[model samples]
Target: MKLVLVRHGETASNVRMVLDSLPPGPPLTDLGHEQANVLADALADEPVVAVCASTAVRAQQTAAPVAARHGMAVRVVEGVQEIFCGDLEGRSDREAYGVFVKTASEWADGRLDLTLPGGENGRQVVDRCLAAIERITEGVTGGTVVLVSHGGAIRLAGQALAPNVTASLAAGGLLPNTGRVVLERDGAGWRCTAWSGVDIVVD
Candidate 1:
């Protein structure tokens, strides 16, 4: 089975770099809507059987066009939403971003104990995301699944679930709006084949 985990399109909060990870987050900006349309077009050739999104409004909106293109409904899957910002909920300052980056980087390096103040630990975030993906895969086999999720949760889960993923690749770069991380799974386990368009080196 293959999983195409996608980051939702841009939002007003994204433009301002605010840490808006809560549910019912802001809707897509004009450019975001265009990006979603482009994403839908890009995946037109894929054998997309199921389209899932987090509880967030932005994620659902981003999945709408893709699901419509495949003649499927966007399944609202829990546990795949953004990492809660906690203390840095709405701040866009360098300090806030620094804390976020440091904590997420630690998680990528296998330091699951480290956590953002008032936010979830790496273990909690990764576990839930992985479980959600597991649930999706149980129902769909040998087919492509599209999951619209947030950048933080996507990166964390990608690194944790895919042994081929390097800490640098997982934490070094940003997952732009509508970016994708592709994964493949078999009896052996799950492997990350691509990150944001860059092909990963499977070990």
Candidate 2:
């Protein structure tokens, strides 16, 4: 089985960095729509068996174009949704950066137990996303499966696939907005086949 993980396109919240402060839902912006379209075109030749996305509007919107192109239905999975920002939702970058930095520092320091106010911790997000991946793998015997999700969620998913490799959240991995990362099962483990949008070489 092959997995293609994609981050949703840009959004109003993304431009304003207010996603963590709002009520947990925000639709994509016009540019986001364009980005999704571009992504759809790029993946037109891939054999996608299923399309899954986070329940958030931005993710759903991003996945819709690709699903349509491939004549696949979009499956909503709450587990792939972005990390909840709690009290930080809807706040500007300047207003939330300090807290975000503090929380991120703590997270980097192995304090996975800490949760954002009204939000879930990295450990919880990873657990649910891993379950989601397991479910997808079970249903797909071969061919590519696409998952459109939030950046943070996708990052955690990548970590799950490559547990021994140390990575930074700020490095953005290879899956940028509208970008794709491919993972394939090998023997008793999973291996990264490709990571698009980053300069890193992929086999």
> Top model by TM-score, which number?
1
Candidate 1: tens digits of C-alpha lDDT, residues 41-109: 988889998999999999999999999999999999999989988998999999999999999999888
Candidate 2 vs. true structure, TM-score: 0.85
Candidates' lDDT values, in order? 0.92, 0.73
User: Candidates' TM-scores?
Assistant: 0.97, 0.85
- The alpha-carbon deviation from the true structure for residue 196 of candidate 1, after best TM-score superposition, in angstroms, is 0.4
Candidate 2 lDDT by residue in tens digits, 90-183:
6776757677656655654457688887777868877898888887767567888899887666766776665432356323353556876667
lDDT of 2: 0.73
For residue 39, model 1's alpha carbon misses the true position, in angstroms, by: 0.6
lDDT, residue 66, candidate 2 = 92
User: Native-vs-model 1 lDDT?
Assistant: 0.92
Query: Could you tell me the C-alpha RMSD of candidate 1 in Å?
Result: 1.0
Clashing pairs in 1: none
